[model samples]
Target: MTRLHRRQALRLIAGATGATLATPAIIRAQTPSELKIGGMLPLSGPAAIEGHQVLKGLEFAVKEANAAGGALDREIVLMVEDDEANTTRGVIAVRKLIETDKVPFIVGTYASAVVIATMQITKEYGVPLLSGGSTSVAATDANEPGNPWFFRSWPSSVDQGLDTANAITGRFGAKTVAIIHDSGSYGYSLGDQVEQVVKDNGGEILSRDTYNAGEQDFTTLLTRIRSEKPDAVYIGGWAGDGAMIVRQATEVGLRTQFVGSGSMVSDDFIELAGPASEGFAVATLYEPSTPNVYGAEFGKRFEAEVGQAAGTLNSLGFDSTSIGIEAVRRTGGTDSKAVRDMIATGLADFPIVQGPEGATAAFDAKGSVDFPNFIAVIKDGVRTLA
Candidate 1:
């Protein structure tokens, strides 16, 4: 079954408590009592695959929390809206989630552009937005010295590019590189960062290319890049596009090592690229072989529910949602400001599953976390730590 279908089939329904009337007349009235959280995600567009994994991660965190008697002594319900990765649609979803659904906070959107667009809505309503995806440094910069309503649990593009560039130039000893990126905010930001890093380290950039997301043909670009004879090529796009690029590169006999952002470290990339994915390196925050206690448990749950091992995106969702729930539990209520403050100040030692060994979730003054990014290479169709 597809992950979307599996999501529908494996829905874990939470029971709600009913309010009882307390009066001398002894008239008992019942009302459903639950805490509602919002998710604004791209469930039906180019970014859907990324969004789906994040949703599963959000579900995993909620499932665990509810099993342990959820936050504020209430069962948590996740209400989601499909933004389709469009800024206008994302804003509408954010407003509806805040005004109509009355969700205490929102989580889980993959595209950096969408997340950046909806930030204003969440801020206007004083609702906290815990982002599990979207790594563009621009997203965090808007939050500046910490915007009260936004908290990012993902590593920034700057961090990912720095490490990946270091891996290409320092480790693999590639002195000349070609860069390709999509036009989206996340992709563009990553490509820019990687280019800067490569130049800073005294590497020569042969060429730079940009394409829209979901573009089919890369033959022309690959042929052009091959002519430049760069030592390595860095892809700053999503898995689907990355897979196609590598596959076409092989078809054109453009023999160069492939390195990319965290988005390339996925089953989708490997399965789509087939033999071409071999030797593909990516910089990412999570490695399944090295999981903390929470990560191990999350991995088992993800595999059981999603029928696949938890990857970097899933880990991102888990940590982001887990932190929000923990904040609400500590706040003793769903007051948005209280929850935001608690997350900003009280989560210094919050344990999470995504970063280095024994890693804990903590936000900097810019409302961004400092997660360690490491290089992983695909060998024999398996993503193994390098």
Candidate 2:
């Protein structure tokens, strides 16, 4: 096999068992126990793209971990639930994941609002919720020691705003920009970040536009933005709505270049925005298919296995499982705390998630990984690195 294919095949294994090398050098054999991890994600709804990815990743991780004798030598039973992304339905889904499934270690709720609401319930039950999605600052910060079981894997929108703004400033050398938000927490947070980033980088803002969620119309907003003709327009919203805005913006002949977050580059967004989505730029975590030494292998394997493309944030859910299972083999346990502690402390040199050049995946103090951020622009109806 070619080196790339070999790497792809290896990554496709998603297990850390049967082979001595794949097993951690430190972890010895231990008695097996039965433990379950809950996966709360949007199986249906506007945000289902992310939900499906999280579910796949969780399942892949659990399978590999189990093959490795489970985390802490306990079987990692998975309990899956759909949050639906609606306020009430999200709350219900998380509650069911915890109470009904009796899963102490639950991962879920991709939307910030859902995470916020569900965190309250998880906190009440003393269950550890390592969220696979939702990067709103609220996920990590309630400023209370009351609930320590919450953690997030994605970079906070606050930090992303700064990163994005800096990137924009460096690229454009423009002095002014406009902010557009979808009036949702995720969109607002992204706009807020971009606005701050623009200001920080010596760029002035002309206006900040806000719209309601599920809005398929953007002629007014585009007209206003087009009239002002800011150097660039920064929009932050999920793929579905963002796609609509992009399509409308193009139809209205809005001349400004668009910059947005990763949520604007999903299956739903791609399908909805169609050709209008092209040429828009975004900042995101992973890019699987982008040509890179490390990620190229995994990227190819991902496509071969799933029969679809993976993005720069480059996981359709299996990456999480791969990392978790490897951690289990290394720590020799399935205990939530044990797996968590080992991942936090011993995962420095680990290579579970791959990124482009010089990109690493070490978890920071907040128990989040060092994900890469790439700027991708739409070209001919596809997101391509700019």
Candidate 3:
């Protein structure tokens, strides 16, 4: 075949020969001497412990990519910002990451509220954001415009709520469930979804209680819940507050099954309340050991790296980081929009940590993991999947 010396032929090959065919400059820019993937996680206040877990996941991905010859022949860079678990701060942090740091991609913000705020920023800039955190109905429920560039690394509350309800009522069959929340969108929204699932499944909610996130004492709610004496409790809140609720409820002699949302599966929750964390279960997207999967190996690697069992955040971070790097490579450059599209349609059955085990799905259209999640239980302060 004769080499195409025409402009139309070149344009057809690269799809818009605008700035693309500027090969030398494109390659030089593609392998950015300083390519930074921004990270925004709550590093202060109640959710600080989770920030470290998610950060470790990001670091591990960066290290792995760099060791394996990096993406697009460029070294990895990380620009981190703390959202403090506040929505306003989270949006601002992401804006800085976009305009100031000039990071083409981002991953972070554990709180759904914080991620929602950052979503506005990423949408404005058209960057591909793969969050190691953030799971709310509002975050991915884009029936109208949709979050075109927003991809989540965890399962949504809708999935978890429906699944948890099925696991509780359909599989184990919870009779009477008491729903609890911490007054944020995270707790209340998820609690509401779970409550509907239980009610739909013929289980009655004995009582629904709401508390402030930072409040250490939940004696009043615990007292009321203990009085009702439900068969099980569906707890919702940040890791810190959720831990407190469990400890207080256990102290007040509430012998109900304490089931928490995704946030409750973190090491922070267990470490904060110690023995009080026993008997609590959390529904989350990733499991440390589930046959031949990256979740188990990532958990092992993280344990070696951090000297402890990986939390929900750690498990998710590994998946998100690996997916993000691969997306960049598959797209063949650091174009944010291409990577975002790759994340959307490109992650259908793609595997991560693929030496011995199989692949891990990064994101589906709904911005979910598109994979099975385990119902992890805390028995004697150790996390084991049920």
Candidate 4:
């Protein structure tokens, strides 16, 4: 398809809006010579490390796809925007990608709220969004067939919450639980799911608290949790905050077992928490020890190119990009509706990096990946499947 040029698209948009163009678009519309895909990520602020990892993974996939003759007989171009994990920024970034860069599909936005906020813009533009990081069930609820533009690669918060809650009650024998989470959609929903599971399993809720995203000092909260004498503390937030909380909990002598989900499964948490990360159990999809054949090869290439071991975020990014490439290849073009249909109803048992012996990623009716969840424990500073 021949899309509008930058100047032409700007003129069309300006004419359509019946308003003066405030500023020129940062990136011009995709040229007819190359196929373009958009990515919105938290490349700054607290989630920079994760965003970089996802970017690296996407880069690797693009390079590989290009080497394999590219998708739709054109080089796959990935244009990214730094959402900074903020909703307004995410909306702006996605809008720029669609209206300015004219990307037919987008692939990211780590924070759940950012994904939720950007969905409307993608839908309005008739673009598809494939996310690897955002895991809130609310996002899944929004991606039904009635609005089939958003598809997620990662398991939902509900799945991870259930796994972590079961680990708390079954593995740790925790009768009383305390919860700490950020005020974001991901954290809040995770906390609710964990709390409900713990209650369903006949556990007591000692305390539930919410904190800002990058709050460094968890001393007061840890002290209160210690006094409450809970058997386990479930933390739902990013890796940096999770590390700080566990470290502070240990310092304040809160001896209960520490459990977490999503970002807690990251090495950044362990490296930051140091010895405090010992015995920390987290729900995760990726484990370095057990990768499928394709994943193992991808990990080796990823380590060589990125100069580090690949994590869950990287794997998720790769998987999401793989599906996008496949969709474009199967459809023979980057038409948004065609790609969305290829993913939602046409895809079947597409291989991915996380799962059983031969793990594959496929979307359910609600656009959630049909995959199993597992609990991994940080034993002796290594994340091993439990």
Candidate 5:
């Protein structure tokens, strides 16, 4: 329950900035005995399930790094806070980490809205943020001219939306589609992109609708969508909202092909939707079937640690943390500016853990990693790569 006041945070940032400018030699000369990375996740809200999985992935990575004599011979520690999927809470969490815990780098924030809100604070504090699950293009774009402190370890929502549109039109031969999304930042941004991609590919958008998060009753939205009678329905939300939509769509007798964002590939959605989840397609960046020794070993270790198979976001958390640790190791110190520069410049060609697409993790100029998005189908309550 630690909170950082605005004045206190600003004062800390001012002090850190002054120190960086006044004594560059002293900043470089000081080598920290241990490395502490901060994390802000929705560990107590509707997104808690996914958030906990992400936490496990981060913890597993830290455990592995510590087992191997730690990063730069300094033990790595993770300081986490529960964002609760709220913007205000997210900002407070980031502030507490930056000013209170004094971590040089942070990783986490599953929801795009949370990441967007927290990144501003990290930028002000001159700390690097390694995002694990926030896929909004705007998250990194907000950094503007030169995003030296923010890095996204996942594919952009724009790419995922385009991939979903291509799969629907190309594989399913759908000429018309309807779009439904939650009212959150991630859903709205991704839904808008998906709608445009569908239109660009010679597909007509029959209808577009939105619902609020934590809404259990989707009958009203489903009824309107049923009236349009599009060939397919695209869900631009997380697994929980996606599950309710699928189940309600079935109840309303709207038998259209259902496709979803990467968030729908989780076991929670599959189990919650039951038979309704069958034949559902999801565009995702992580494929557990990645053919690489590193991927296989990571998957095995993740399952052994969490007692369940790893999902896309789990792998994302692992990659984001691993890349951050590599940046810290390359810098040979815990200085935030040095780590940020190394990540921005040296991260592109450096080899880290393999992503779901079997590609080595690399960051672009905008701090986004390039990875292929694949469409997966849920068959008999299991997600299979399509």
Candidate 6:
């Protein structure tokens, strides 16, 4: 079934008392024995590279939490599933985690489309879900009321869109631009926001186009964009696809400046695009090169555990899991209702791990974190703060 249809069905099955029903006597009775946390991620699909990085960060966080004496004096157990970046698979993975594993709190699914689709299952089971990487604005839109079980650890695309637009026009002095996206929910929503920001900032959108995720060839789209001869091109997609577009744009002689959203900051993009990635600009949240106390500490811990420097996905994963653990501790137990209430009502003042930006993470009423946005450029195939 389609993602929308499945969400509708799940919502119907949940009915009005889904929240109360989800808190079974068995769950409350078993909370004292073990504190189980569930997670879902792409793991084996188009977004797997990003998903795996996020999972590693979560694993490291769980390890740290356990070493620090665990939450509420109970050992924490993390269970994960592979969503494969597919909505149907995401539904199944989340269901198994919520029902079969009986985890009260879950984290995961890097792709915004997967998060959007599987969130219904969390609502049905009354499990709180903390987004590890998804950045679509719709993920926490206040208009869609009733589900308070959702929260985001990263800044929304709205922040990235506004940052990119301002950087393109204010810094680069671009008057017109062409846009391309992945045609998935994340890319499309971010692209739409950037398009509006462009217009609002006294710039013209020369052309707009989209490509499906995992598509390699972009000659036709690049040729069409080249004809418009915009001052720059804005890309709203993941690293793999964005890298291909940059390489092909070079081969086709599309000479416009390329600016991208946060997803373009991955090492995958730099490795795939090689020399073509130079001079590419992106609006992102975390810049490892920027010296900060939190980044330094997190970098050391992450390198010790995963043997690599931390990136955006890794930082987000660590922060989200840390926040969830703090909420559980504050509530004094693993009751889903109590944890959810703490997150919604007292998350703003909760003392947790600082974000990569070296600021204490605070959540607005919408469950979105307020963090700084940064502009970076690819210099010698490496992303450096601009």
Reference-based lDDT, each prediction: 0.78, 0.64, 0.71, 0.78, 0.77, 0.76
Candidate 2: misplaced stretches above 4 Å? Answer: 1-35, 62-77, 123-126, 143-148, 289-294, 312-316, 327-334, 354-361
List, residue by residue over 1-386, the lDDT tens digit for candidate 6.
01111111100013246346553232543466567888888888788877887888789889999999888898888899999998888888887777678776888768887888877667666778888788887878831443366788556787778778888877888999999998888888888888888888899998888889899889988988888999999999878899899999999899978998787776777888899999999876665665556666776777787877676777777877887888888888777877777776666654333334335545555666655467889898677888
Per-residue lDDT of 55-145 in model 3, one digit per residue for the tens? Answer: 8878887887898988778788888899899877887788777767766678877787777766755765667677757778687764123
Return the TM-score for each candidate structure: 0.89, 0.80, 0.86, 0.89, 0.88, 0.88
Candidate 2, residues 302-335, lDDT tens digits: the string is 6676676666333525555455555556765445
The worst-scoring run of ten residues by lDDT in candidate 2 lies at 5-14
Superposed by TM-score, candidate 3 places the C-alpha of residue 282 at a distance from the truth, in angstroms, of: 1.2
Compared with the true structure, what per-residue lDDT tens digits does model 4 show for residues 219-313?
Answer: 98899889999888999988888999989988999897888877777677789999999989888777666546766777788888788777787
Which pairs clash (backbone N, Cα, C closer than 3 Å) in model 6? none
Candidate 1 on 86-124: residue-level lDDT in tens? Answer: 887887888777767777678857788888877856765
As for lDDT, the candidate ahead, 4 or 6, is: 4
Candidate 5 structure quality by residue, lDDT tens digits, 103-168: 778886888888877776677667888885788988888775455467886567887887788888
Off by over 4 Å in 5: 1-34, 352-358
Off by over 4 Å in 3: 1-32, 143-147, 170-172, 352-359
Better of 3 and 6 by TM-score: 6
